[model samples]
Target chain A: MPVASLREVQKRFWDSLAGAAGIVAPELADAVVSGTTLGSRARLGIYADAYASRLIDVLREDFPRVAALLGDHRFEHLAREYLARHPSEHPSVRHLGHGMAPFLERRSDVPRFVAELASLEWARVEVFDAPDATPLAMDHLRAIDARDWPHLHFVPVSALRLVRASWPVHELWAGADPARLAPATTVIRVWRDASGAAYHAPLDARAAEVLRLLIAGAPFVIACEAFTDRTPLEAAQAITALLARWIEDGIIARIG
Target chain B: MSLLPHLGHGIGLRPPHYPRVADGTARVDWFEVIAENFMIPGGRPLRVLEQARTLAPVVLHGVSMNLGGSDPLNERHLGELERLIGRFEPAWVSEHLCWGAYGRYYAHDLLPLPYTDEALAHVADRIRHVQERLGRRILIENVSSYLTFTHSTMPEWTFLAGVAEAADCGILLDVNNVYVSAMNHGFSPHAYLAGLPPDRIGQIHLAGHSDAGTHLVDTHDHPVPSPVWDLYADAVRRFGPIATLVEWDDRIPAFEELVAEAERARAIEAEVLGARRQLA
Candidate 1:
């Protein structure tokens, strides 16, 4: 019998993992997959099962909250469908779920909050592994000359991320009961603490605006100017309190 | 000969066992980390690796090198591994003899390769490229195969020996994989062991597998069965004591349980080599 080329063999094996049973290469089935108690189809089934289960298990880890909200049966179903649509592109399993949230968004049974929850969950994984930075402390802020306060630009930590959602995704991430998944417009800050634990905080519109402007390299006074709906005194107070919280949370990498 | 040291006995450093291992009190000679896990931008995994490194040496074993694939090497993946090796300075790095991806599609499992001369050349060239990029030689392990290619003319061990010799790499020699593949494909495990080039054997791996009624899957979730313990004895007797590790990747038990398995490997190796010396 003629032997199949490596390329032909790989395409068949890869396609067979997602394909129906008995779809493996003809030579692999006839001459390669020698049988014992198990038939060749059953042997191939072991690998096929492992391929799906391993990738599905990875998705489950990355989107635990989303999986919890949807339940296991539905999540597994979604995982299988997602795998067919988005075969892993990278060598590492950690990257297999890069587009899971977007994939979840297109599902019919999925609520927007569930997809948003997936986004938050994915963000946490990212922040958990993101590069650490030396955060700016209250002492660092105090060290800054008051004369440069208006011109100061705060550098955010590498792990710091801001995500906007149509639902209160922070509640879901904090283990909110599925029955109470209220759809409220929310912006949340996600970052890793010094010991590498990930935490998320819900941000008010004013706080989100300040963080957005500051993250975009806006000067301190200009960042505070984003609170147009509030009084100047109120905006100043909110900015002061927000800066203190960020500093305490170690989200500010530097203030210049 | 291997520049890698005989690091006594060790277990795969799983995430669930991190708290105990990082507690700085867990007794272990070394920890085997999945190289891909630490090949990340940054986060708790690296932090945990730092903590584990303080306790014992770590070996970076990988599953996705795609050494037997037809496509060109993934430079980005190689670069990430190089950076990781620089950071961890592991005792050695190892990957399977099988491929994991083709083109942009990664199967994420150790897919079987035909042990034909053409494939031997293909994989050896890839291993050479990998060694050049890594700035150090690597060890390639035999994967527990669910299927074999009719095109594979030589036995798996002959292919492994050929690749190691042709590429100038070392053999990791996963013993349970030999047992599992032998059972699944009707090959003699003893022949598989004897066929290996002795000088190239750098490490040995012992892992648990599940019998799925029809066939056994290399699950690495349970205790090492008696047959594998018996096989490990043969391996130590034949290869004459190499660096061995217990791999428990799925449904990992407590750190104590994992450590106990590693200890079992230590005891078995001692018993076997001791008997060998008496016979000699």
Candidate 2:
């Protein structure tokens, strides 16, 4: 038999592992030396099994809420499908589930909230190691002149993320009974505290609108318009309360 | 014989012991971290790594260089590794001799290569390129394998030695992997050690393996097994007092327990070298 080139051998070996049943090509199988206890096919199967098991473990860690809701068997099945469709492109396994939420969104077999829940979980994973920044203190906000308050813009910390979903995913994420929940649009702010701990909280309608404006780089006066339902004096009070909360939460990185 | 420093025994820094590392209580000779894990922009892992470096000398051991793969080298991964080297200033950097990625897809496992002339030349060239990019020599560790290719022209040890010599790099001799692959491939572990150029051995890795009825799996979940320890004694006799690390990736135990394992390696090395001197 003619010797296969290095490239050809790699392609065949990869195909066998990536295939549905780990069926090694005859040429590739012939290339392998069968041991006394394990044949060439079985030896190759070890790699196949490890490839799936290792990746599934990574997915389980990244989306524990989704895995818990779906149960182990169903989660494993969905994860295998996800892997087949979208193999890891990143060198680090940390980025393995980058496409998972979108993939679940396209599927109808899972619950309606599963996709949103996945998005929320992935956001936490990203926020866990996104980047490090010195959070802007409340003193920075106080230093701004009253006349310039309307034009002041705030920059969010690098670890901050705002997730908007049609379903109340935060409730599910918090271990709320999925069966007792209804479809409700929610905006959740996820960020890492100064001590490197991750946290998330659902925003009320007014606070959500204001945070959205602030995250979009809107000036303080424009973002305060989210309180249009209140009087001018009341809106000023609401904006002050929200700014204090955001500063305490360590979500704002800079105010200028 | 190695140009690398003879740092004492150490353990791989894992997340379960991050608090100990942060609080300045975890004590060991050094720490070996996965390079890709710390290649990110920021977060707790990087912060922990910084703390670990301050506590003890840290070395960067990578798993995804894919030096033997058919695809083009990943420049972005190299760039990140280079930046990490600049920031952390690890004692030395190392990666596996096997490949893990192909054509943009990563298997995330140390996939073995056939020991043919073609593979030898390809991997040697890739290692040279990597050394040029990082501006330093790297130690390539041998991975455990379940099978071997019939079209190969050489043994695993010869291929490893050839690559290290041709690329002018060092070897991160993994004793447990040698035993595991030797058991799986029906080769003699002693011959595997004897074939290597001793001067090229810059460091050593000791880990546990699972006894699958047919073959052993390099799981690194258990304590360093008796046989692997025995092999480590032999490695000490051959390589002298080289830097060694205990690896426990899965089912990681408490920090003290891991450090105790490193201490055990220290004891064994002392025992072996002491006997050698007495004989002399």
Estimate, for each residue in B75-190, the C-alpha lDDT of model 2 and write its tens digit. Answer: 99999999999999999999999978866899999999999989999999999999999999999999999989998899999999999999999999999999999999989998
Q: Spell out the clash pairs found in candidate 1.
A: A32-B150, A129-B42
Model 2 residue B106 lDDT score: 92
Error of 1 at B220 (Å): 0.7
Q: Which runs in model 1 stand beyond 4 Å of their true positions? A: A19-28, A175-181, A229-234, B1-3
Taking the tens digit of each residue's C-alpha lDDT, what string does model 1 give over A17-117? 86653477665566455565766666667778888888888999888888887889999988998888888998888888889889888877788888888
Q: Please report the TM-score between candidate 2 and the true structure.
A: 0.99
Q: What are the DockQ scores of the candidates, in order?
A: 0.75, 0.88
Local distance difference test scores for all models: 0.85, 0.92
Pairs that collide in candidate 2 are none
- Minimal lDDT window, size 10, model 1 chain A: A27-36
Per-residue alpha-carbon lDDT of model 1 for B1-280, expressed as tens digits? 4337789899898888887766887679898898888887887788889888899999999888888888778889889999899988999999999988876789889988888999999999999999998999999999998777666789999999999999999999998999999888888899999999888999999999998777778999888888998999898888777888999888888888888988998998899878878988
